[model samples]
Target: MSNASRFKFFKSHHVPTLTVLKAAIGDFSYAPHAHEEYAFGVTLAGRQDFFSGGQFHRSPPGNVILFNPEEVHDGHSGGERALDYLMVYAHPEQVKPLFADVLGHERGADFRSRQTLIQDAPLRQAILELTRLVTSQAGSCIDQENALYRVVERTAQLGGHVQPSQVTHRPEALLDLAREYIHAHLEADMSLDDISQAAHLSKYHFLRLFRQHFGMTPHQYVMNGRVNAARAALDQGTPLTEVALRFGFADLSHFNRRFKRIYGMTPHQYQRDIAR
Candidate 1:
């Protein structure tokens, strides 16, 4: 049989400090790499084996894995069948406070174990729920936020950590300025430099802070805004091509792909559903 694979990234409005990944792979293997943020995931089907810390880990269906910031790891399918899973990469600053709240202490901490893997079914289910909320655009922001908190709390309880103090959040005004620039230029081809300038910060620093506060990168935020604008124009019965051009999309096909990625439906389908 031919190998089939898929990977998707989802941005959460409520949990702006986390980005979700959904993947199914048959033959792909990940090279050893380290993330600057916390990586947590649960295997849903087949099996996945990975190398981390000083040893290897085998994660079967329903097993959860957690990697602290800068933890080195590599992943591959354990069998012929594809492995399906959902992963959430979270900013440590965002997770640490929640960890403190779960432990009812002010000390900062990381996961207790470098080789963190759990077989708890209930926590696995909770992770799945949080993944669904973050990936689904239908949920209210309040609901998504509450679910995210609960999932983090559960994860912290499972793998204990102890640090000294909480992480400080970036100033709100800078983030606001960056967002204001994005909204004002939704129909223009905006660049990272432009957005960073609006925030009066370096591009790299601005990119990190933007993702922490928005749950997505600056480019993603701009694309989302453009798609939202396109949706509004379509809802008014505008032609697809016109809508695409008006929203700064290169063409109708590009607009359709982005819209489908975010909303899980093409523009025509969306219009039909709204009409009904």
Candidate 2:
């Protein structure tokens, strides 16, 4: 087995209920262990073989693997080439509502598979996008939150086991209040406590409801608001440094990095493109 490998494990800074793993392993095997959160991943390259649900399964590039909470499984490289992939472990609360929405219900349905492998191109792309957004520091909170919803919606639809809830509940008033506060304070230092207070919710309850309602945390919402404001200013030929500071970024380099990550170009490049 080759030894050129890397592994990283971390939580999403913007969405605290999410955890992420990015790994490239040439010679490692996992012991049978279970997670308290739902686990899903996409194979970026190479091959991985694992045992679950009374059978062995192989996942090649562009394939997806899913495990419901507490499902036991083990994995290893299926070939000499390293296995490169990004995996997400999400809390049940973060996913349940999306599943409910997709199924046209509001309660009592869960992913009904033991170890599921998916090869649908669109679903794979959605999962990849969700991993990218949740694990990256760029993009607005709304973008990340929407991407997350897409992943859950696609996954639940593909699974084909969602049951409709008897009643539907909406929290529009609270969500609107939160949005109003976030937009009004785009240039200020917005904290979870402050945003939650504005919504008259406890921090924990606010995080869950906010994510379910808007698909992002308060911090992500504020950051995205700032980025959007910066984009508008840049479009009008605002000086890059002034735009960055005026929109709440600490400095020009920080703004440049964030802008490139979200818009796929630096501020100057974007301005040049717009001019032509």
Candidate 3:
């Protein structure tokens, strides 16, 4: 790693599903991507710019960049200076418990941070403080949990928006069917027409509703599913080429690119690395 571009990833044992990253980027730009986790970060220096939720946004020092689960975005250093930032990713299950204390709700709610960029002093402090525990790995479980809880509360208090439970009811069942079809066919060539047919809807409406419910296009969902399933196969000591083929990746190079986008490493790296 050099000053031009560097990244360090850590898994937070305290919050089992929480992952943290500290990065400085100058030359590299991130591909448009999304995660299953609710993600937010604070710019530590320089400026960070990205597009999400239909608009471009900037996060300078002390500003928060928020992304709801599975929301697509691409990022890059905003100016001549390298971008320094700290990001934390937490799954819905990890964040839901905090909502009960923050918003008086249980884990059943769909948590969202509606704004793409938020400026809040308390939220920034909370985010930075939580990263201390994750990166340093010096805190007890209780200490780490407390720091994470504060971050979650501050985030919800400042930028949180919940998706309404009532959606177009008819679509929910149909979306599930479409999702299943996508997963089942991940090892095969899949098309919008094929998924829509499985869901019993026209292609365009199915596309719209799929994005509305899953926060990603069906194609994005398929790619993510393929990468995820391939990761699982790798875990079971499968060969990289076989894993890629089984998951329907056209070839090793294609699999490598897709895997890196999601897991931050090539399939070979992920398989060989003992630390994640």
Candidate 3 lDDT over 1-276, as tens digits, reads: 234776666777666767787878876777677776788799998889988877888888888887887688888888768899988987778777787667876633566777778888888888888888887776899888888888778777765567666556778988888978987888899888999999999998999899877767888888887886786577567998899889888899999998877555687876665254
**Per-residue lDDT of 84 in model 1:** 89
Model 1 TM: 0.57
- Per-candidate TM equals 0.57, 0.56, 0.83
lDDT of 2: 0.71
lDDT (Cα) of model 3? 0.79
Q: Put down candidate 2 lDDT per residue, 168-192, tens digits, no spaces.
A: 4445577667778987887777788
lDDT of 1 by residue, 61-151 (tens): 9899887764556787787678988888777777777776777766634544434788877777877887887776658877876776777
Off by over 4 Å in 2: 162-276
Query: Lowest lDDT 10-mer window, candidate 1?
Result: 163-172
Q: Record all residue pairs in model 2 with backbone atoms less than 3 Å apart, i.e. clashing.
A: 105-165, 145-215
Which candidate should be chosen as best, given lDDT against the real structure?
3
Task: Report the error of model 1 at residue 8, Å.
Answer: 0.7
**lDDT (CA) per prediction:** 0.73, 0.71, 0.79
